[model samples]
Target: MRTNTGRLSTRRLWALSAAVLAGVGGAFASVTTGETKATTRADHFLQARAAPTTAMPPTATASVTTESPATTAGRPVVSPVLPFNAKLTSSDIPVRGGGVRSGACSGSLIAPEWIITAGHCFHDINGAWVGGKPRYHMTVTVGKLKDGDPGGHTAQVVDVRQSPVNDLAVAKLSTAIDDVVPLTLPDKAPEVGQRLRFAGWGSTSATVVAPSDHLKRGEFSVAKIAPTTLEALPVVPRTVENSPCADDSGSPYFVSGDNRTGNLVAIENSGPPCPQPGREIIARVDILTDWIRTQTGDTAR
Candidate 1:
């Protein structure tokens, strides 16, 4: 299937239909009944690029650029760009043998040249993640607190490497981003009830599905810990006010309160539309810590 930004291909349509049947496109399902069901929308690239009808406000201030460093979770916080926005220009993929086109999703910067995101973000038109070359091109923007913030970096994704054990992937940028601090990997998986904070550029609400122009964060608690996934329930602003929405896949979940220096326990994997109150499913990064370090050639111990 050709992946150029033209009309959607039949195979792409079929893959999306298959995801809906497989319960993967829950990002588009609705539960406004005011009744919380165990809903988790693991969107596999279902993009409806609406205008920024409701972009969530930035959670952190221009702290990255402050004259004096502040602290959170007991560590000095440098607002350098760690999390980022990955903008895609491909068809909405349900699974990248050519899916996961998701027009945009949050990404975690672990190395100056490497970024880890949900594996679903890259694939062929057939929904297969045949790593190395991506069917479509992608651009990454970081360092900026919000769109138009001049203090950041931008790069084109030149290559990609997908995970075999989890819903994760690491993309190689055209150039190194040595100025910003990268988020640290975890030494162990998170425990149930552990508190975490996450930020993203995904939609603010289900109804406002456009990816945000800035990063918005909220608090959540680890409800269940699995080998490859962590189920978390939002708590900070309550469920409906803030949480992952469409195009939020691959955003980071900081174990320490200080996101800048904290250990990334998880990455936004899938969730029902924004503020679902139901647990939002995130992919475990602990499972791929070594894999990530190896990918970036960062062997420091």
Candidate 2:
């Protein structure tokens, strides 16, 4: 099944008519007397049954500037241009024909053998949660700014752990990736109007739904800081030119005070189409810091 933006992968076009796993309702499903049943809304990338009334925000215009020979500047350039290689986080889900899915969301290395991603990414084809033998297989690729880049570390998931309340999950890798430095988890939650960076291998165009094999990064201004989530507005071209889109679930959001160092702040959960005017909900890492430490055996307090 194809969407207006573009053709969707077979793995992505699932029916909501069938019984599916749990998901967050855009506007928390309301309940009334004698009716406790709540309907679920498809998380990010899932085709929307309801057409969005609001159109996406207009792309901002800016004067392009050149960067030093060593460092590139302005907007999230596609991979190999301004490689986000230092952090070592990347989009991990593989697609058919033996390649990583474009716009397949993202995850970060919290430890040499552990990756943190959005909980929704862990669900099965039917959108049902799975364990032990996951209905779907997942592979984590590190040190790869572009999908075709060589010498990167790739590991299959050996185990998975998901949160009970929020949309967060930890995956244990079959092998350790020691060369790439793991990202540091922040101890505090982000505040409103703060600048943050989010990168992924998702779709880059505002209207297109296809994913680019190259890594792309973008900046966002935090608008709301909830206990478990943060809603942000895209500030692309500042650090990136793209917004997260289909298969961009499980992407990492970072808080970089020094602009060189990043602290894992949240996991990309759901949002409207890329470059669209909608709340990009990110799963806050600070609230789940303790849980993450416990799950990954990172006991540092």
Best by TM-score: 1
Writing each residue's lDDT as its tens digit, candidate 1 over 3-106 gives 11222232111111223324532122212222223222333353334222233324342112322223455433334544443333233233323223336667
Summarize candidate 2's per-residue lDDT along 1-301 as a digit string, tens digits. 0113343332221112111115533212211212111111123333332243243222221111222222225322222322223221223232323332212446777788888776655554454444444433455665667666544555667787876446667788777766555678888778898887777765555455444577777788898775466777887532224666655666778866554346888877665444546667777788678878898888867
User: What's the alpha carbon RMSD for model 2?
Assistant: 12.2
Candidate 1 has its poorest 10 consecutive residues by lDDT at 9-18
Badly placed stretches (over 4 Å) of model 2 are 1-103, 205-210, 236-241, 257-261
Q: lDDT per model, in order?
A: 0.59, 0.55
User: Who wins the lDDT comparison?
Assistant: 1
lDDT of 2: 0.55
